[model samples]
Each structure stands twice: as C-alpha cells, then as structure tokens.
Target: MATLDLSAHLKEAKKHGPQARGISDMARSLVGSEILRIAGEVKAFAAQGNKVLDLTVGDFSSKEFPIPQPLEEGIIRALKAGHSNYPPASGVIECREAVRQMFERRLGLGYPVGSVLIAGGARPMIAGIYYALCSPGDKVVYSLPSWNNNHYCTLVGAEKIEVPTRPESQFFPRAEDLAPHLGQARLLCLNSPQNPTGTVIDRDALSQVCELVLAENKRRQQAGSPPLYLMYDQVYWMLTFGGVTHHTPVSLYPEMAAYTIFVDGISKAFASTGLRVGWAVGPTDVIERMSAILTHLGAWAPRPEQIATAELLNNGPAVDSYLAQMNRNLFTRLGKLSGAIEALKGKGWNVDCISPQGAIYLSLKIDLRGKKTAEGKLLRSDEDTRKYLLEEAGIALVPFLCFGLAEDTGWFRASVGAVSLADCDSFQARLTGALEKLS
Candidate 1:
C-alpha cells in the first residue's frame, strides 16, 4: 500500500470550507432529548425579561429545596480534610460499605460491598450496565414515556421493545404487558416511582414481574442462552407520597438478586444531582464486569463526594428528616398544581391531571387539540399544546413526547423540583387565561 499523504489530504479537506465532522453511526442515529430542547426555549423566553414558571427541568433549585444539610456539611468537611485524590475504580471502601448498609436497612436487600459499583451518576451506572450485558441487536424491554430508556437502547445498539403503559395503571407496566417480551429480551429496564409519570409499581404487580423474570432466567439457563437481567432504576424510591410504598424486585423476591442490578443514588432522594454520585448493586460477577467497563470509561464519582455520601447515608436521623421535609415540600407543590388542573377541568376545560403519586412530577392532560387559538393557530399535536401553554400562560412544562411517547399523547410532566409553592399557586390563573384564549 502507498504511504498516506496525511498533510496533503488535511490541506485539501480544509480548502473545501469547513470539513464535515464524522460521528459514529450510533451517535448519528440518536436523537437529542426533547425535554432539554424545550428547556432551552424556556431559557430563551426568560432571557427576554418575561417572568416564566419553568417546570421543564427535573432538577432541584437550591433556593427552593436544598440538599440535606448533613450531606452538604459532610461534603465540605471531606474537601477540607483533603479528599481530593482519585477514588477506587469501583468506589471508596467506606462509601461502598455505606451503600451496602443503606440498602439492607432501608429496603431489606442485602448485596455485599463487592457487588456495588459507584460512578459519576446513575447515567454512567445505567450505561455501564447496558454496555456490560447487552450485545449488538439484543432486545431490551422498557415502557414508553419513561426517562432515557430509548436513548440507552439506541446507544447499546439493542432492539427496543417499548410497552405502552395504560393510564389505568398509572402509566406503569403490568406483568402481563411485559411477559410477552421477556423470552426474547436480554435486558428489562424499569423505573419507579418513575420520572415523568410519578407512578410506582404496585406490590402485587411487581411480585408478578419478579416471578416472570425468574422464570425467564431459568428457561434461558436451560436453553444455554444468556440470562435476562433487570435494570431497576429506583432513584425516586424515597419520594413516594401519601400511602404509596416503593417496592424493589430483590426486596420482594430474594431470587431476583441473581438477575437484578439496581441503579440508585442521591440525585433524586437528596436533591444532589449536581454532586455526581450514583451506584449499582447486583450479582458480583455482573457488577465486577460493570466496574471494569466504568473504570475504562473513567466515570468514578468524585472522591470528596463519595466520602461525604458515605457519612450522609450512615446518618439515619438526618436522612429521615431530610426525606420527610423534602416529601412535604414536593407534595405541596404537586398537590397545588393537580388541584388547580382539576378545578379547571370542572369548568369545562379539556384538561385533566392524575393525582400526585410518588415522584416530584404531576401528570397533566391538556387536550387542546383541534381547538383554534385567538390568533387562528390550530392546536393540533402535543407540541402545539405545549407551545400554546408556554406562550400564552407563561408556564413551561415538558410534554410526554419528550419522554418517548407519541406526539398525540396530550400528556405532560410538570416537574416540581425547581418550582416553589408560590409558583404553583400562580399557575391556575395563567392556565385559565390560556385555556380561555384557546377557544
């Protein structure tokens, strides 16, 4: 072969305007998050000096809801004590031990410290699990209107089987819905109290799911195929409201320990998303492989944060107090918005809202489709309804399409993470005006 003329090729390529940048086929096939795109529009609108109640982002506003005081103090102390070095590829020993204890104490699930892998956040842990277990074109099952499962499936080159959850079940997948797909799936991704929908799987439903998974794993083993694994994303487990209890597969059925990998962290429970700490707990072999994958990717959680998190998880009183207060604050905002939407529905507005269930999200339905605006714009799709609400009500919310739902699913997720009680209180009048103007 002739020697490559690298410099000549570079010079010629530069002459043809800006050279086209190349991305992997996988990267090129992925679509960006519509939630973030809507958030960008909200930012631009706010930049014009208009007051907008932005509920698009699933993030805590430090002013409205701060991270646990103990966690914050512990982080400060860790930094002061010179915990700036790199952490173990898996995690600091103390942090892993703390995670072990936390799961055992809180959820009655016992995984050895060796089975826990820490990473920058739940995203990395999730990606690592996908990378570790899934082969190209392997089937991965999840529910639609979920958070990031589709994107993860795309990233791993797995065939996605998105089960459409029904509203009657609070938009959570039933065992029957998922049973049909389990035989062919290598990974089943689940989240509860789910992002976007704020729903939790009922105990009975979850028990059945665990049974199905166990059965599938047995069949796979008999057939000499790789076992199906469940990636349980329970980041919002602690945020369940009212009498709703969060359930995990391993907790209900101990046998699930062999096939379930938990993706959890302080991102939601403690409102520490920016702290960049999360973990995965699973079978030792799977976790070891995931740890190796994450190690090569260099996605370890920060040393100081990990050290601080260890202290915080072990602080029972502080964790309990913070969770109670956080739940109260979140519920107040969700309740207010849900009630306001119900009131509007009573007044003949084509709007409805599910009662706040678990997470800091309220499921809102604004069926403004086929309605004509004052400016003669027809509200056709969920996007149209989203824009109408944003422009006319000065209220920003994320449509279900952002969460991988169909364009016509008139549903939206109003995240209360960044909004305050006062912000929710103001939503009614603005929303009423917007609805009135629509007709």
Candidate 2:
C-alpha cells in the first residue's frame, strides 16, 4: 500500500451530516435590534476616541438628587447582616407586599400578594408573561414606532401586527385601527409615555382601547375562540414630565384585568436599573403559571436588594422625592432639546419633532438629503448621518429604524435624561455646528 499515509487522505473525506435544530424557528427569525446594533458600534468607536459624549444609553445621570441615602445604607446593612442568600422565586414576602400596596395606592387597584411575580427586570417579566400565556402560532398586536422589546411577542412565536401610530393621532393607535386584528390577536403589548416617541395615551383613548379589546375578546369567546391577552409595559410609569400622570392599565376596564399582565420595574422609577428588579402583577392563574415558569429559571432577585427596594418603596418620601427630581430634571433638559430641534427646523432643515409629554427621549427626523459636510461628504440615511455626528460631532443617538418603521429615514432618538442643563446647551451648539457643516 506504499506506506498507506493517513495524512494524504485527510482532505478526501466529506463533512458530517447536518444536526437537528433544537432552537425554535422564531428565535432564528429575529434580527438583532437596530438600536442595539448601532449603539454597540458607536460605543466601541467612542472607547477609542479622545472625547465622546455618550448619549446612546437612556439611563439617568444626575447627581443633584441621589437615590435615598438611607436605602443605600439599608442595602449594605442587609448584606452585612447576612441576608444575601437565595430568595423565593416569587420574591420575598415583604417586598411582594410592598409592591402590592404601591400598586393599590398608586393606581387605585387592589392586588393580592399572589398576583405579583418578581423577576430580574421588566424584560424577563414580559418574556415570562409571553411564555405563560402565549403559545406558538398566536398573534400579538402593537402600535408602530414602539419600543424595540415589543418584538418579544414575535420572538415568542406570536405574529406581530404593528398598527400605525402617527403624529396626527397623538401617537396612540385608535380602537378602529385595531378592529381587523382584535378578533385574531392572542396578545396585545403596549407602552405609554412610550419610549422613543414619549406620547402619553389620554384617558379617553386608553378607555377606548380597553373596551375594544375586551369586546372583541367576548365576541371571539362567544364564537368559540380563545380569549386575548393584554400585556402592558409600565417601566416608565413614574417618569412622566410636564404634568402628565402615569396611567396604569388596571385603571381602565378592571374586568379585563383578568387577561392583562402589567409589567413594572424599578429601573426607570428609581434609577436602579443595575439592581435588576422588576415585577409582573395580574390574575392568579397567570401568576401561578409564571411562578412555575420562574421555578425552572431558579432563585429570585437578590435578597438584600429586594429588602432594600421594599423598604424604600414602603416609604412615601423616597419615592416622591425620586419622582419629583426625575420630573424636574427631565423637564428642563427636554425643553433644551426641543428648543434646539425647533431652531434646527428654522434653519431650513425639514424635521419631524414630537413634543414629549413624558419619558426621556425626543424623537427627531433630520433631513439628510442634499447636505454636504465639511469633509465634502453627501448625507444620506439616519445611520449615515448618525455616524457622521458621532464621529465628527461627538454625539450619539439611536436611529429609529429599530422600531420597525420603514419611513423613519433620517429619524433618531436622543435621550435628555442624562444630559445636564449646561451640557445640553453645549450639545445644542455642537448639533447646530454639525447641521451647518452638513448644510
């Protein structure tokens, strides 16, 4: 066999047979969120730069009003007191009670302890709801230009229907707009004081949505169809600006409360996003299902953190102070951003600007076409101009294409929550400089 060298025949063999696919097709179908993708790249770019004002993350960055000092001391106390063990998956009884009471008083709704399921944050709470309530081949409806996480419905194997939400309708989808899908939708996920757009749904509009969803659900049931579920994301419920009170889904059509799962977290309200504490409250059956689902995921939130959160929430002063400070800080910065945007529009750029009633972001549509920069480059889409601004102007913004809007060319989301009033003035100047260069 002339030495029969095995190495000589190594390249002659073909590859192995294909393996079975364990992951769901839905998971594979999802693309990474556009905002996250761009934000990641911009962050990497900024890391190497000498100066970069990172406005990409929407987290608050004010030192004027710190998180309650006593609460921080309490967290340290809990840790030092050796309360750092694993907790009940449903959450500690004390914190759960505090959550229940907070909802009861804040939203004027009564919820027993069994109705709440604590998780890492609003994202998990939302995912748990989808897992517990929605099966594959279900349909989930929402409005367009909504939060990117709204696609979690699709990731959970539900068909996502995005109703058009425009400036004319105050950025809320009309009940009539939902008529076609109401009969078939298994879940409707929504957020108000909505992210990116910051449009609050009025009491009348919210009431109409509740009535329509419930009425359609009843019609489906009478026709032997399964009841639809409503999932409300209320993470920003407390961060309203300009005299807008947060509205809970439970406030409207309490009867449909049986079918709605409300997701709330301490991230936005308390600026404790790093704590990873959030809860979902709803009907007993839903909670029971979520509890079982959470068990498979194991140990609840950190015990000491939960205790600290409960103690802070139990006190009215800390929460009130936090809310007031947040409102004041955001109001001032939003005024600055709005003014800058208006001035840009006055400078002959066609821009679509939404006056934010609440939330931390200002959605902007900057005209990038027919613009030449100092570098002699012609402007194009939002991503193109976003990169130009970040690299040339040291500013970072999330382009709006991540929210599934096709006509969102040249659109971006700028967060004013972290920028101080002084910093905002500087930012406005930098923005105008960039605009002039492009023009």
lDDT winner: 1
| lDDT (tens digit, per residue) of candidate 1 on 1-439 | 8987699888877675532555568887898878888999999999998889998989999999899888888889999999888899999999999999999999987778998888999999999999999989999999988899888888999999999987788888889999999999999988999888988889998899899999998888899988999999998999989789899999899989999999999999999999999999999999999999999889999998999999999999989999999999999999999999999999888898889888889899988999999999998898898888888899998888888786577888999999888999999999998888866
Global lDDT of each candidate: 0.90, 0.77
Please give the lDDT score for candidate 2: 0.77
TM per candidate: 0.95, 0.89
After superposing candidate 1 on the true structure, give the runs of residues whose Cα lies further than 4 Å from its correct spot.
1-20
**Full-model lDDT, candidate 1:** 0.90
Q: Candidate 2 lDDT, tens digit per residue, 1-439?
A: 5877786455444232222334556665667777777768877886796366566666766463356665688789999999977888798888899999999878888988999888777777877888887787777788877786556766677777888776777667888888788787888877877887766778888888888878887787789877888888888888777766667657877887877899888877777767778898999898888878877876367888888888988999878986887778877877777788888788776766777677777777776766778878887667678888888778888876667776646767788766667777776678777777765
Write out the backbone clash pairs for model 1: none
Q: Evaluate model 2: give its TM-score.
A: 0.89
Clashing pairs in 2: none
Clashes of 1: 0
